[model samples]
Target: MSAPTHTTTSEPFDFARAASLLTDAAARAGAAIMAHYTGGTEIEIKADSSPITNADRDSQAIILEALKVLAPEIPVVSEELASDLTASLGPRFFLIDPLDGTKEFIKKRTDFTINIALVEHGRPCFGLVYAPARSLLALTVADGEAVEATLPPDEAGADLSKLAQTRLRARVADPDGLTAVVSLSHFDPETEAFLSKLNIAERSSAGSAVKFLELARGRADVYPRFGPTMEWDTAAGHAVLEAAGGFAVAADGTKLRYGKTEAGLRNPGFVAWGRKAGASHH
Candidate 1:
């Protein structure tokens, strides 16, 4: 008997395809969240006493299931479900925050977001942040291209490929022209003290990771975060900013990296800056 011949034609890695899938997954999660947003937003307290809504759980389920199909080989460390990020993660993994701003969500604010990112070698390499209320999506497709896009206002026929795309650019801003974006609800004096030293031209406040977008788009120059945060909180936003030619750094000026198991997924005080925003941000 003749030996059986193997004819396998595997496709090359498709960055665009992966990005589209991730974006579509975010859209689905967004829809899941919207369903609850329209109904009663019953709130539950986590061990941390932070708010958790049905929307968060529902969205997490949608994203996690999609990720299983999208990249079954990799593990996911999601904020709503993961108990230990370091113990649960590898050099390559997915990090997600199904609903990043639950307080904002409860308050009926649009700043809440759905975060998804791929972390490799302690760096956020690709990510997508979908603001379902705003119908905005931002991502990097592993091509070093970061973009902010919009799906159709109509959610039912959402298509990531049909997204209107605008490549992001972190514009240069000197100290005198710099505007610092701070957390609207969590801003502390330490962050204010840090910003004061820069003498930034303006101060603006917003909730959640949307500040990352402000920096990535040149709408703002710097973000000083001095309070507690988690890896999932920043990873997706960090990937988008880095791909847009900007960076986030600790107060000590070390570039922020992911998978800090010792810290229990918590992040230290840090400053995120746009391209050429100046050394003061560090």
Candidate 2:
């Protein structure tokens, strides 16, 4: 099935169809990652000191090839291949992180995910996050519509239509207190200070796009990060959150935008809130 090219036509892109197609692609990538997860795989450190394994490359190959058949006209900006990338594509393109949370994966944790997102006009319109280790899949099928499902843990190639999916909606924030999802590996003082200002009743620690999944599922209230992050790292999760009636913004509270060519595709610090913006948001 071919996808409608947003760059060449006036027709509205078929987000639901695209989400289904990409979820399969993400699932295939997940299987490849799981193959490596079970064994002792050699790791190589990137120039930025981030780790990469053969699993990452294998997953990238699978997703990139799948994107070609699914949406040939749309260019993809993927994490494993964008080390020296300094420019954006046209108004529409794909952002892929074949394997997010490498640290968690390396530590034999279950928080890693495969992230895929479509960015149009500087905002993510469609997104998919598949945590293969946990058999959890989350995605945006349309504006204000996101869904989560549990895939068969051992069958990454399982039929998606057979899975039971639950619609996701961010819960309204409680005025008295809130539940915050914090990064398990990258916690810092700035995040601590930010959470201190809010009436936080509890804090849940997680890695990768799982934090966004938590908020999108109404399991958490807010997620904030002051540390550096790349666009591919957050776009898919941001899209899922937005589709579930949530929002993510830069440090100044403006909506987070993609395609940062001048910034080398790096993202500024951002805050994500479920349902509504925080009254005390800066």
Best by TM-score: 2
What digit string (tens of lDDT, one per residue) describes model 1 on residues 139-210? 897546799987533344356767778999887776566788999889888987887778588888888789
Evaluate model 2: give its lDDT: 0.86
Please state every model's RMSD to the true fold in angstroms.
5.8, 3.0
Q: Mind giving the per-residue lDDT tens digits that candidate 2 earns over 24-62? A: 777778888898999767899998899999989988998
Scored by lDDT, the top model is: 2
Model 1 lDDT, residue 48, Cα: 84
> What clash pairs does model 2 have?
none
| Candidate 1, residue 263: how far the Cα is off, in Å | 1.2
